[model samples]
Target: MRSDRDQVGRRIVLAEDGVLLREGLTGLLHRFGHQVVAAVGDTDALQQAVAEHGPDMVITDVRMPPGYTDEGLRAALSVRRVRPGLAVLVLSQYVEQTYAARLLESDGAGLGYLLKDRIGDIEEFAAAVRQVAAGATVVDPEVIRQLLRRRRESSPLERLSPREREVLALMAQGRSNSAIAEALAVSEAAVTKHIGNLFTKLDLPPADTDHRRVLAVLAYLRGG
Candidate 1:
């Protein structure tokens, strides 16, 4: 069960330029008990709405009105500068490694980077929102895969057997060794061996053992 602090719904302000997605997300979140304090289509209104509503969270896209380059990202950064604790969940239609890095660089609570395409899974998206609002990090599975793929291309993983690459992909998807084994119809011991081999070839640090998986992917994404 969630603690009282979490059970209470958060006030959310949304900024998505796509009319249908913006409204659809608003409705979904509202159904989940979160308050839709404001929903707008442009950066100016988004910023203004945030100021006026003082929402607990902000769901936005990477691009919005005006230049449409990265207006939403810029707006989120501005919000962070003024209200350091505000939760932000950014939705993007495509992978922008740089944009994801910028949000991660903030080092703030309630940070999220998810693709809008996944909005079809209402429960998953809602869970991400709640996770971020409660001060957890949530990166989209696709983004993680993209980041990992970029890294693997240059690394010695290029030498791994095709089967090993498949195992690594499942691991990159946040699956455990046991789960990967089950999915691949292999033994957990085999999965463990594959992971060790991959780690050794990649020369990733052993420190923060629990987080190194994501870190490894992030490093790859950053072209490390």
Candidate 2:
């Protein structure tokens, strides 16, 4: 829907350890009208690909070869250092709040963190690619769940009313005002009021609602 007519096919590099998935995702991206400049199986190859191709986007797995613990995150951080505008989409099978925190700590522009399970909805997932390319941060709902679960062990969130916590959790799930309202049996106006209150208490920057919601979720998890 939001495809850039002038830049419909941005260059991309993919890094994933799973051979089958790596190839499959490359094919999907090609079908969506993007150029797969390079696809590799490990972080080393990822670094090399970035150095050689200078792709506009890097779709990498959170776990990759050579100490598959956080190699992808490390590679992403490295690329951000060299090319701040490069969009990155990180895929993972598990939700790790620490990885999310680290990724968003400095810069969140043109970033996406999604789970492998979400690959089923090809259309929606492709939309996420467009969103990230347009400089939006797309975080998966499961990652938000991890962030909220990590938040409950803190003070401010611990002090929030049960209803407020419910709203906060749903917000982290990337739900829009109307969606959250329907889920909570409230009006859209009521959802907006709760969001305002939450942002005020959390001391988050008043920006676009979606980005502000992301800041709130990140702040909650970081216990700021």
Candidate 3:
């Protein structure tokens, strides 16, 4: 696990409508050795800054000026479309599964979606930023837990054994098999077996790439 301080000097673009929160985040990033190349309060400004600065990562609120309903998320998607691999970390007051699904439905690399309350844990928040910038997926654990609870009654996930579900949750957290094994106090080979079973039960075909694992996790998140 990389600490917040281990990942420093990243160039960032921030977007938030609230002046105080935006300023506070800017200060925090600066303190953590990241450069806020641009800070904007609206979608258009955000788009412009991303184009101009091409920051290593973007951190934005889910709601922004003009209209507070998902403009920030939409803008983030647009930025991803224009700049394929640009890392994006979204902060929201609420967990909107639809927004999260849309974000993950893309390439699934260099993405993050976390709640605003998580900002209080400055170290965790900073680490998330670093993870996204490093082209890793970082979904909030709450988001995963909520999705699991909501879909438990009717989803294919109900077919999973308890241990398999545990494995799947850790997979959704973007943990590698070794990391998952360490977390679960199991052998790496056991983790691999569990992962294989998860994919088979989820009806995900094997692929040369590990993206099959990502797809399986997404299926679980989507309640299928």
- After superposing candidate 2 on the true structure, give the runs of residues whose Cα lies further than 4 Å from its correct spot: 1-7, 156-224
Clashes of each: 0, 0, 0
RMSD per candidate (Å) reads 11.7, 12.9, 13.0
Arranged by TM-score with the best first, the candidates are 2, 1, 3
Compose the digit string of candidate 2's lDDT tens values, residues 34-76.
9999989999899999999988889899988778898998898
Show the lowest summed lDDT stretch of 10 residues, model 2: 1-10
- By lDDT, who's the top model here? 3
Can you give the TM-score per candidate against the true fold? 0.67, 0.68, 0.67
lDDT of 1 by residue, 96-138 (tens): 8888878888967789999988888888888888888999999
Q: Lowest-scoring 10 consecutive residues by lDDT in candidate 1?
A: 215-224
Candidate 2 positional error at 4, Å: 3.0
- Model 3 scores what on Cα lDDT? 0.88
- Would you list the C-alpha lDDT of every candidate in the order shown? 0.84, 0.84, 0.88
Off by over 4 Å in 3: 1-8, 154-224
* Error in Å for residue 106 of model 2: 2.6
lDDT by residue (43-162, candidate 3, tens digit) is 999999999998888999998879798999999999988899999999989988878777888875999999999999999988888888888999999988877676675566877899
